[model samples]
Target: MAENDSFHHVLRGLGPQVEHRGEVIVIGLGRFGSSLGRTLVDMGHEVLGLDLDEQRVAEHSDSLTHVAEVDTTNVKALRQLGVGDATTVVVCIGADVESSVLTTAAVADLEVPNIWAKAMTEPHGRILARVGAHNVVFPEAEMGSRVAHLVTGGLLEYVALDDDFALVEMVAPDAIVGVPLGESNLRADHRVTIVCVKPSESGFTYADRDTVLDPSDIVVVAGHRSDLERFADR
Candidate 1:
């Protein structure tokens, strides 16, 4: 696999698993939307992708379960495309704030059980939320933060759980290398908990207090954002 695909695979593995197997409708076939649809399909879920741009629709036709060129802002178009039947609808028209908002509103009016939208800015996210989006994502900002964490050196990956908490994958700190987790006192000292450890060899295992940290091991840690930053800096 390509490096980007490998990275995405690792990231997905680190996230919580979903048990639901249902149809998903993704509106706006941009990079984010297309990736989401493809991932959902890879996870054994049926996906319907829609976009205003015929070129975009054509590009993903072979990859997605279904693809259609339709204006998501039109309630009639969405209904005709069976958007109301989807288990979830994701609006991912980040470049066009107007279209994104309108599409989200249209989906909301349909009262889809799950509605997710991507916003380009804080105000755009607020607008999407106001329009009844169950979740709003600021992809650019989130990516920037992830990159910043990696640039700090020991951190391999970072995922924000919320404004205050984060989950980070990083190399075992030198101070804790070769020490039993119980003796490391990371939780008491740094207010962080090691949830999983990935050895240099292969798969990850749940971390236990008796688990010994190898110098080459990568550990997934969860804690408040500030505490995580401090732990990483150490």
Candidate 2:
């Protein structure tokens, strides 16, 4: 796997970086919300988990910095819980579109510095954005797209920088093996740039124009998604 991919996997397994530790309030204790709260707490941040379900609140109480059973859609109830004071708020009521929108609006009304929400669809995401969510996540859709890329790209790992650009790791193609990068003219031919090369038996190294690629070498490239796909096809 690529270094970036490994880094992301580590974050999922443990938590985010601790550099921005602060008070975070996560409303709705569903799987995604609970996971976010737990990860935040594990990263040394103070995470407060809120949910309408008493059982869910109870289940995450020990893992989080704080847990409360509250109606997130109620502005008065949110105010009483000091929701406005949170540095960051994550609304995770994705299953219920109404609740998600209402909760996001309420948090935004509180003037929280950062608000992240989960949406089930594009329209839902747009609604959340219009209501004041700083970031909207579509877990299922994003995962499905990632799986599709993995299955079709024949790549060791892939990370999208944006809709058009991506970083990908793959084995050196037979046509490129034993050839110097300068002579290959990969950038001119495929519109992709080799960022790094990881030898099967050793660590990673920067790819220079004169670097010779071997069949066993794994190369990390960056370029537009279409360009990378074309390059990988070879």
Candidate 3:
């Protein structure tokens, strides 16, 4: 790369040697990037969005703290755009695996402390990890699995803490309705713990052993995925 690499960009000055406390740089202003940048912006964090497409830069310019058109695969371009000073950088290039991997490699070369990359497949995730992406996310796969669980189980909300463990929100089942939770022996009988419960008329409160559940009430349960499924079914 030379001084005149032809990938001109309009970038905001990072100012001095200090990295902003709550700022993030997002590469590839596609759907994921736009959503993430806007979310960060909404959360009161300054987000810089970078992309190769001028249209993408223009479209997200008003939404993020700053938007720029730059070839992120070029390490020099990223450094010149002040990406090296970012505390966190995320590569959200979804379709083009080659560009995604190369961009991740470039960000790694910058030695940014935190690096996150989106991957379309397991192999892509492995490649990103090998190239120094500290966190590799399979968003589509995770979302699909979550939706599948929601569809199959009669759950109001299902959040997977990890591969095997999960937290779920569901209506109080007949098995536990009318029985005091402590005496119900749910933890011993079903292997699920009721963390909290919400009656129809009030907001949620912590569940204790003496808490008696009522029908039509909602409960938050934490347990292994398999146990949660069985408990939810009952």
Candidate 4:
């Protein structure tokens, strides 16, 4: 091609850097998806966000690489918006299973490299999985424990390292009292690592595994969600 032709070709694709940095298309600019888009943009990756609400799109204009108002139920409109070119397409729509299904199927039909769909229920998750979603995120169910913890004041903090991994801090319950860390075998049996132990009583040193668990000792642990839930129960 001639130089002028090449220059014109580049100009034609001038809107966003969808091809560079591995494009990510996030449908539904709701709370979860909006946060995800902002994080990706902050990381210097390209993100294209779509939502049915124009106000939501406008709200994220500063945080996302690109934002457009579109009804994801229309697969053709999704294609026109370049959903097919995305390296990863995430559907973050909640509550409406039909819209979620349509969007999930649209992305899959476009053959996006990865499709991640957020589900509100176990049945929703199974449906997304059946439609070839690379991963199904059950945000409500996954974070349900936090609500209980917050109400009871038993949890000091919650940090999600990833979809399945978490770091939690909680007051040690009566059951773990008098048990040494080494004997508890938290790492061996549950794959949970105790990063720190803060005793309710003063002048307590929790530097080694030989340290015995005391009532009301604040424990910080890193583990999978299930293991953490079980640990919290104990």
Cα RMSD of all models vs. native, in order, equals 7.9, 7.6, 9.2, 12.3
Candidate 1 deviant stretches above 4 angstroms:
1-21
Residue 62 alpha-carbon offset, candidate 2, angstroms: 3.2
Comparison by lDDT, 1 against 3, better one: 3
**Which is superior by TM-score, 2 or 4?**
2
Report the lDDT tens digits of candidate 2 across residue range 197-230. Answer: 9988999999997899889999999999998888
Write candidate 1's Cα lDDT for 1-234 as tens digits. 775443333322222233344788889888999999999999888899999999999999999999999988999989888887675888989998899999999998887877778888867776777787777777788899889988965788998876678899998988778988999889789899999999999789999978998889999999998898888887
Q: Which ten residues in a row have the lowest lDDT in candidate 3?
A: 6-15
Give one clash count per candidate, in the order shown.
Answer: 0, 0, 0, 0
Top-TM-score structure, candidate number: 3
- Top candidate (lDDT): 3
Candidate 1 weakest lDDT stretch, 10 residues: 9-18
- Model 4, 1-234: lDDT tens digits are 775443332222221233333778889998899988989888888898999998999999888988999988787998899887777888999878999988898888888766778888766766776675767777776578557655654567887665578788887756556877777777777778887788776643444678787786888878998788777776
In candidate 3, stretches whose alpha carbon ends up further than 4 angstroms from where it belongs are 1-20
